[model samples]
Target: MNTHAMVMALALLISSAHLHAQDTVVIDGAVTDRHGKAVPLCDVIFNPSGFIADDSLYFKCDANGRYRAEIPAGHYNSLYSLDLPQYAKTQLEFWGWNLQLTENQTIDIAFDTIEVYSLAVWASNGGSQSLFAAFRPMHLAAAKLPRLYYKNVDGTPKAIMDISPTLTKSDIQASIDGEPVVLIDFHWSYEHAGQCSAGKDSPFSENEPCYMPMIIAQFHKPKLAPGKHLLRVRIQDHLSKEIGEGVTHFSSNSMGLGF
Candidate 1:
């Protein structure tokens, strides 16, 4: 081969080798609360910040909120699924630091805890329909609120609201006599000046204290008969903070509420 041709061929081979090395990077990360407590079962989602609309990469934290995912070596916006329906949307920002995934990188995500002010269950509208409940969360000021948007739903909006809290990343469950009961739906709202607005509607006025509303888990089966029933409620925040809890006597005729 001629000298000039040999030099060009060698340069091309080196460039190709570098490109191949760039494509083999992996990402390892751990999800934890701000206090260093592990956040288990949290979804770790990777969104490409580039023009290419690639499908988001999804992974989950283990029982200790640790996760590992192999990445294709690119810049991405890491998002953690930290469920905080009661705080202002801005205050609930769960995005991690921007990630530039190179060769076998490691990133750690830390989230703060959410506050649960109160929790209660009641029979609204004369109890003809299923049961309803309310959980009041601590509100965030406007400057720190997150943006709220709408998404499509499959069934009745009421049912969707009732079931949301049950599906939270935290372990939230209600059972009777060691038997599990189906939570039909989940709902949430925001409270300001004694008036509550649906969470989906955002941009609250900055004049008053606005709080994220609590999740109300509804029950349609294993009827809450008119007698003594032990009601237990527990809630943990992103940082493993037990922000809300309740253990009280419930009766069909009582306005069920315990802090």
Candidate 2:
């Protein structure tokens, strides 16, 4: 191609790039706690709808819990806030789903609601962590004893249990469609130990048992007709006298599969 033609091609490429940049929208917001104070250094993630799990946009809020980013305008399957401080006490980490971003907008996050995170049912016997999904369906025949996993944003289970000796399995309550579901066992486990540690004078000893966030409850799977069902779980912290609850919908089919 001639020099002029090459120059024109370059110009066209630049123009296209400019137009693509214009297609982006700015997203800004602040993360606050129940006391209306900023939650600093919180992580925000936006997962594009119907995309791979690794495909996501991440941003971190400033010291005042304010965040801003320019991203391509599109729909998101989920928006999550992670790595929140214990003082936040948010019940849910997943803030929004099926979100559409067409223009610049401000989306503030707050932790005033509840105190649990990642509350969901697992289809396995709770022996291995591989079978865990935030919303995995429960197969009644395969997993007659499905387990519930959740985390307390306020403090670790061991710490709470230390303060409240009376805390027991009865503190956790579950129901399906407003019907009580019998719980068989309750236990606590760490979700991610590598990211947790104890400091000198910390309530934890030697930081040996840190990061025990996951509270598991095993229950008998009830028979259900094919369709959607609502599962509700309520937890009361005996030490703080605070209550946190979570609700999720699962589908049951003839094959005893939960969706």
Taken over the whole model, the C-alpha lDDT of each candidate is 0.49, 0.56
Question: How well does candidate 1 match the true structure, expressed as C-alpha RMSD?
Answer: 21.0
Q: Candidate 2 on 112-190: residue-level lDDT in tens?
A: 3343444566545334221122321111121222222233654744331111112467766777777888777776554
Tell me the spans in candidate 1 whose CA falls farther than 4 Å from its real position. 1-21, 50-54, 81-93, 113-259
**Residue 128 alpha-carbon offset, candidate 2, angstroms:** 17
Off by over 4 Å in 2: 1-114, 124-166, 197-210
Using alpha carbons, what is the TM-score of model 1? Answer: 0.35
